[model samples]
Target: MNAVTELLAGWMPGQRWFGGKGREWADVTAEGFLLDQSDPVLSVHRVRVTYKDGATETYLVPLSWRESPVEELSSAFIGAVADPHGGENYAYDAMRDRDATVPWLTHLVAASTVGPMRFHPAGVAYIPEGLPGDILSTEQSNTSLVYGETAILKLFRRLEPGLNPDVEVHDALRQTENPHIAPLLGYVEIDNGPGEEASTVAMLQAFVPNASDGWRLATSSVRDLYAEGDLHADEVGGDFAGESERLGEATASVHRDLTRVLPTEPAERDWYRSLAEQMTSRLEAALAVVPDLAEHADGLRRLYAAVADTDEPVVRQRVHGDLHLGQVLRTASGWIVLDFEGEPARPLAARRELDTPLRDVAGMLRSFDYAARHMLVEQPGDPQRSYRAQEWAERNRQAFWAGYSAASDLQLSAGSALLRAFEADKAVYECVYEARNRPHWLMIPLSSLSRLTSLV
Candidate 1:
């Protein structure tokens, strides 16, 4: 019932991470609890939000506000705060607010037991000095709190009717409810919905702290092996063979659990048709800019064609649509997949659709390329970087794919060809993605697609 004039509203849609910023938000009613009473009111509050457009949606946005934010606030997970001059201003992701993020974690734990919804307890997280904000380098479905030393808590901005897979999966894993993924202490949700009141707004779980992303971890391992002109990742301290094998097996275990949680239905061809159409738009739009892909346009179309018409039998179930290096955590315990929320450009309906497990596999493979190239970007002209990237992608992609396929009982429609199509789709998507978002990072995907020689 509080009528707080959010001056930073307009500034939100401009952000890569602010999922609802592009549309008009009508009726901004607010509710939340303040984590800190002093120093700018660190409140774990949200905007009972709405969006205006043809395909309309409503969501919950966690807002972190202060009387004023410190300089470089985004680095601290500050999203937006009011400007002194009465204009809209952004801070960082709310999860970066230590006062808010840490308290939010403990709050979820307490609420799990005390709240009407009893969440299974998993691990505990305490903010250490220099805890990092969620990876801000890209536009992701949700923002997170990454403790440089410990755990991560994903602050969910968008709301869905059902319990978020993140909360469900993590809690299951934490309670020894399942073992394929990372642990979850539980999650935080409000009691305010139909059938279920107050949906999940955020999740607090064990952070796989200190783990490099799988892509990064793999490259580090490959660097050690590739320097010796070998394709194996078993030579270095960061040897990826074991990790990759485990990640593959881990992904399989996740699918097993998913099959248990989600009911299997007949594979719907219409879903694939619509998906192909959407990808067509993205691919066509990308072709206009990156002429290099013009020749591949037909290849692209032929690729997506498989989505709808592949003769191969299909199995439908939920999957991590945007699995990649950044989405995975390579902890001492093992590799952990994250951010079930799919590609930002995709609508929730489409992203939530059950598709080929290979789609997730494709995403991870593409990420292997990004991880390798990113390492090269750092050292620039480091001979070892090139060799290392390919070796790592080669070794781990094989392991990841082998493990996932074996576990999921999947037989890809075109095997390597479908993989190429996905790569083309992912690369084209990344190209436009980099062009608009990180123009400098355009080379990452462009280079990846360009060098995509036909995989034998």
Candidate 2:
């Protein structure tokens, strides 16, 4: 192994964006590179790694190489490495190097084409020039850089060799003049090679200023309701039912736009059965990991079975594969959806699969339950607080459904069985996730399973 590859093997396992966490690295190799010849060279390298379990993943690593260490970027410093030109240089993540990143922004603004990469603005009248930039401090699955307050560019960390749905859906929504989503300002695409499909490396979108995360808003509302000693959820001054309803409407509107621009298919009987089977498989897998769920297994099975027995065909479209509160932003105008990339862990084909929009609805409903119950995890002994949490979740859930049904053709309220099945499936997925990642929070979803099954 070379100096850089050897250093990355140790560093990759600790990164939040690295997919191979908790796994032993069997091998790491540099697959491709895009290098800029300069004093502090800017390089984009694709690293392919194989784990001990025989699984493989590819990640994009952008680095800046300099002769001297940068004191301000000490935390980002990778290690000193011998340069091919017969000198030693220090390397750091290129995103933190303002000078190196400036050229990338310039390329986008000028709509420049270099080698196999294309940097062009889409659906925007003009590109802002010479704007100051900063990297967002919040850690995420991808790296994001904000150019002033006008736009944010998200660089995908894991390199998938196909069309990224975030760019795809945003471009389509921009075409329909959809206002509920951030307008796609521009994107960077690269041609892999002859006969290989081009990949979207990064995307730029209009940054919604003064926006609050949907998760924070919902949780804060729940906290307000819990604080009011004698008042019910609706009677409280910080009621989130109105905002939840608006969010539902926005979600439905985005779904309509996606259906209009993308190819959709009817959810026939065979598709329904396949979905139910997938749910059943997921539940069974969760049961193996979380034995506590075994008690509610039968109740969950009934809900999934009900969906398989339904003969009515539902409309399937390119809905958001993952639609939790964290994926939305509430601005002064309205709720704006972000990140159409779907579930990051799932394969590209599965994430892009056409499914009933209710799946997204179920995801949001589960998010509401999470937002309500998460605050009460530490105060478990208080029955009154738990009751209030449930009350808040139910009220907001109903209001959301009402707003969604009013705006869309589907009468989601009438399809309680399907909705319950989707919710149950989501909770099962959560149960597994919590069991593996956050064991203490496992009770939140376990309690949800009890409530959902008891209702059925």
- Which candidate number has the best TM-score? 2
Give one digit per residue, the lDDT tens place, for model 1 in 148-246: 535566656665555665565455444345554665655666555357545566665555556677655665664566456544455655666556667
Quantify all predictions' global Cα lDDT against the true fold.
Answer: 0.61, 0.85
Error of 1 at 446 (Å): 4.1
lDDT of 2 by residue, 22-52 (tens): 7787888974455566656887777889888
State the weakest 10-residue window (summed lDDT) of model 2: 31-40
Off by over 4 Å in 2: 32-35, 84-87
RMSD (Å) of each candidate, 1 decimal: 6.2, 1.7
